[model samples]
Target: MNSSVPYLLAILGEGVVPPSTMVCHGDDLGLLRGDGVFDATRIVTTEDGTSRIDHLEEHLSRFARSIAGIDGPTPDMDSWHRLIEDAARNWRVPGEATLKLVYTNGREVVPGPPRGFLIIAPLSETHMEEREGINVLCLSRGVTSDAFADAPWLLGGVKTLSYAVNVAALRYAKSQGADDVIFTSTEGYLLEGPTSGLVVKANDALWTTPTGTTGILSSITVNTVFEAADDNGVKTATRLMRRDEVLRAQGAWLLSSIRGVVPILSIDGHPAPHDDEMTHRLRVWAGFEE
Candidate 1:
């Protein structure tokens, strides 16, 4: 948007526009009511001025599912593909950045098609630092693990624009002198982080919470790590776990798109075991070895 904003490239539709260009208006549902869906992935730029987007197809598929969760029209995948390519082609800063896709339900004041756009920007230093390790607090989500069952309206597993609660959770954790939070169901089952997925090492296998009824947003990064682990003879599972179990587990980590894999150092002031080998392996599996 301004000169002070470091390395930003935006594409609203098939054309690239200035970072400060207005992509949405006041009446836009995404702004006024948070009726939108989005997804993001890592974009690594090499010294050769070439950028590579990881889990590109998986991000698109999940984004489509999010749009469907909101009963929105299907996005133009081809246009988005072209726009992403254009954005990546122009983003040759030779560093790690994020590629985000945003789609909203149309404007209410003046009818218009849904606003879809792509953004490429440099990653934050904080995110990079967290990749080293983190101390998280377990917070209650006020919903049972099965609260979303048979209730599509709950939008379980949907990546929506309404993230105020997530922001609040993170703020609360910061106030508590913690780096992040792991949301648990009212029944006390570990769900996920505000913006990341929880991956616990237990019984010599990699396990994460379930999605369907757990109201947990499925994590592409976790899936990528699990896939890599599978290839390397590690077992993986999807199941519900509690904070006590996480504290007693062999290891734990928060995996996400932008941040990659971040090992958990402690939870709620309770120390958890740290496995350097496991952390390094998870990072490499998640493609965030750097």
Candidate 2:
């Protein structure tokens, strides 16, 4: 392992390794093939060293969904939380930090026992801030056929370890001089972002796609936003939204745990309004009152 990569901390089951340890053969296989699903959850640490797992239970539930979707082994919530807390303790990250829990199928193509792997790494600084707004580029649905419909759609909702298509989509968006991409269905309905939720202000209400209603992994950020918005007398709803409605929205965002709530500056070449009242209201409601 290269010392320059800056390894903060790592936990392998009951064992802990420093920055110079090499992974097991099975771990290499799973990671090499991208045969795993993972979730990102942020932890808030106090100056005195006290730590609270933000939305821990919700993240664990999402982990269960990913495990079940890939027919992989499931870990007990109590035990998994313990592992996460242990890793976080070792990290000693100041303030708030994002923790990523990964579960892999252990490199077996055929059906076999799957104990998988778990990892906790420091999140990049880019995701920790409240972005001014995002510029999104529209992409094709047929290419990522997994995200086509509500349920049984092309594994769009599932957080599968396979992300070849996701990388390609983001790269293509970057080539067009955009910050991110908003994927839609063949029928022209808004779906989600590469790593975030579809959050838009429209019809004088806070709206997001009903991926949760369709058996998809309901985004914790989306739920948190709704809670905050509703508390502030803002109407929030989860429903099927058309592409035209999204482009014509008053204020738009890609809400996620790490990215917080990101506003959209442009969509498919058209510039959007910046710093609207709705944007400020939604951000405050989401606890990002910054």
Q: Write the per-residue lDDT of candidate 1 for residues 100-183, one digit (tens) a residue.
A: 899999898998989988787889888988877899999999998999999999999999999999999999999988999999
lDDT of 2 by residue, 241-265 (tens): 7666776777778877866778888
The list of candidate 2 runs beyond 4 A from truth reads 1-6, 24-29, 46-50, 109-118, 128-130, 143-156, 212-216
Residue range with the least summed lDDT across 10 consecutive positions in model 1: 5-14
Winner by TM-score: 1
Candidate 2 — worst ten consecutive residues by lDDT sum?
141-150
Q: Which segments of candidate 1 are over 4 A away from where they belong?
A: none
What is the C-alpha local distance difference test score of each model?
0.90, 0.68
What TM-score does each of the candidates earn? 0.97, 0.84
